[model samples]
Target: MSTPTQKHTKSRKNIRRGAIRLKKISLANCPKCKKPVKPHTACAFCGSYKGKVVKKVRVPKSLRKSKKQEKSKK
Candidate 1:
């Protein structure tokens, strides 16, 4: 059993245990899609990371077929 004064002191000590710190999130812009993304992670808009293309992105159907045909001819 602790006295009321001791209980109050313990609670006050616990209150400031984690009050002087913060976490910093790293943010960067994707060069390809020009959207914000976390550092060293693949960009959700263009599916690229660190200036390298990692994933193929989807385009609208109206533009997809014409783009594919042009590429096939090349």
Candidate 2:
């Protein structure tokens, strides 16, 4: 087994860890739904990819709610 000969300084450790930090994911708007979605992936709201419908996404009328309805309820 081998151990580090010297203790790493706080700033040095932090500098090395800076590169391991989380990176913000880049997102693109879905053309059909205008919602933020990961690029090269199907739009979850509209089920479209690259201007083509790849999957059929259906929301039942009862499940679908509008802002007007929510505001009225509130």
Estimate candidate 1's alpha-carbon lDDT, on a 0 to 1 scale: 0.83
Winning candidate number (lDDT): 2
lDDT of 2 by residue, 2-23 (tens): 9999999999999999999788
By summed lDDT, which 10 consecutive residues of candidate 1 come out lowest? 2-11
Q: Per-residue lDDT for 1-74 in model 1, tens only?
A: 96665445766777887576788887888888788899888998888888898988787798999999999999
Point out where model 1 deviates above 4 Å.
1-5, 10-24, 60-74
Q: Per-candidate TM vs. native?
A: 0.50, 0.71
What is every candidate's alpha-carbon RMSD to the true fold?
5.9, 6.0
Would you list the C-alpha lDDT of every candidate in the order shown?
0.83, 0.90
